[model samples]
Each structure stands twice: as C-alpha cells, then as structure tokens.
Target: MEFFFYAVPSLMIAGFAAAAYLLVRRARRLRRTWTHGLTAEARCLRMFTTAGGGGGDTSVHTTVHHVYEFTTREGRTVRFEEENGPTTVLEGDFVTVRYLPELPQRATALPPTPGRLAVGTGVGLVFLGIAGSFCVGFILLVHVIFAESDGLLP
Candidate 1:
C-alpha cells in the first residue's frame, strides 16, 4: 500500500515532465520553421488598449496592431492584422512576418530580440503545471482506492 502511494505519484510527475519536454520541443521546431521558411513584409498600423475585470481583479492589456502585406507565388496579394505587445514592437516600423505557405493569413511577427522564446517557455511551464496537477490528483485517487482495498486505510 505504501509502495503504491509512492509509485503512482512518481509516475504521474514523470508523465507530466515528459509532456512538458515534448511541448517545448515542438515549440522549438515551430519557431525554426517560422524563422527559416515563411517570409513576408508588414507594417505596424497602430496601437490599441483594452481593459476588463472578472471575479475580483481588474486588468488592462495593450496590443500593437499590424498589417502584413505579401504576394503569394501565384500572384495574389494578401493582408491581415496581427496583435502583439507594443513593448516588443512599435508602430510605423517595417516588420518581417512568417505565414503558412498555403494559408497566408495565419502568421506571426518575429520579435527582434529572442525574448519571445522566454514567453514560449513560460507558456510551456504553465501548461505543464496544470497537467501535473491533474496527474497528481489522479494518482492520489488511485492510491487511495487501492490502499482501501488492501485494508490499509487509516
């Protein structure tokens, strides 16, 4: 019973850790593909701000609006808006964008600094933490059920 408790939690933690590792790896691959393959030109159109409150906390967020213009190899011009933080980008600046070769509207503006990588890391960690919590809960439940069956409950 004791061994089951330890083993189940350990396995759960390991599983979450593995998932986090895989997610980070995938994000890295996506970053590489965006950096090397897709190419487009865009201009920062404006900056926008919005505020919202929920539960008990209020917060405001800023987004830099941008318009990307590019021509497909088939000779069709495409344009779209992209929202990002103004701190990392500015208005009236020409920015490089990467889009899906087939879906020009789906794109991202590459940050000048590698700071975006840090953001990606933070996001990955958040996802890992949530998954880890669920896994740990499940393991605890399993341990409790099995221990009870073995008359080990106290």
Candidate 2:
C-alpha cells in the first residue's frame, strides 16, 4: 500500500512530463528543419492510409502517409515517408522536400503548419488531463484512507 501510494503518482507525473517534452521537442525540430534544412524537389512515390484503433462503438480515424524520393546536393538519393500531407497531394505529384544537410534522408515534404502542431498540442493536453485526474484521485483516496476521526469532510 505504501509503495503504491507513492510510486503510481510519481509514474503518472513523470509520464505527463515526458509527453510534454516530446511535443515541444517535435515542434522545435520542425522549426529548425524548415529554417535551416536544404530543399529539393521530391516526387511522391506512393500514398496510403491506415485506419486508427477502433472497435466496440469507437469511431475510426485514419492517417495519410506518403513516400517520396529526392537527391541531395551531394548527389545521394534518399527516400523518406511522412504522415502529414495536404489532401490535394497525390502520388506522382512533385512536392518540395526539406532535409538536414548532414542527414539527407531526414526529410519532410511539408513544413510544420499551425494545424499539425495544434494536433500534437491537443494530444499532449489530453494526456495531461488523464494523468492529472489520476494523481488528484490518488490524493483524495489517500486522504480518505488515512484521515483521522476528526474527518476532513466535516
């Protein structure tokens, strides 16, 4: 009981922190890739969509992904896939590619948009809410279990 009292809440808080850190790091990486990365023209090789988790009355979601290839300034050809693309993009269409100088394969077909970043932000918020509620519930349960006869409620 004592271990559960402390460990679970600590884990929950740590999870919340990790999620926030990941989202922020992604935003920063996208910003840097847009500002400092080299650009080349890439031809979309394929486009596909996979349905997200769904069952038992849960609504299904889908994500679009694309694979493209471009040659770097050094003449090395690289292929990469990205999940976020405009709806108008189609296989065989040419799109702008941004890639890191040192790692030509690290590329994105589209720059980070406010809408894409907002989706990550929203996901982080939902995770925070879940972890926060768990921690709050833990505190209340501990208080009730260890409360004196004086009664916190009274």
Candidate 2, residues 1-154, lDDT tens digits: the string is 5557767887888887787788887777776788898899999999999998788889999899999999999999999998967767899999999888886776888865767677877787787878778897887777676575344343
**On residues 1-154, what C-alpha lDDT tens digit does candidate 1 reach at each position?**
5677768778878987988888787566557647655676767665555444544565654445555566656677777776554555666777777766766666667554446776878887898898788877877787777678784565
- TM-scores, each model vs. reference: 0.53, 0.78
Off by over 4 Å in 1: 1-26, 45-47, 53-55, 85-93, 112-119, 142-154
What do the candidate models score in CA lDDT, each in turn?
0.68, 0.81
Q: Candidate 2: which stretches are off by over 4 Å?
A: 112-130, 133-144, 147-154
Best by TM-score: 2
For candidate 2, the per-residue lDDT at 111 reads: 63
Provide the global lDDT of candidate 2 against the true structure: 0.81
Best by lDDT: 2
Cα error, residue 43 of model 2, in Å, equals 1.3
Q: Residue 47 in candidate 2 has what lDDT?
A: 93
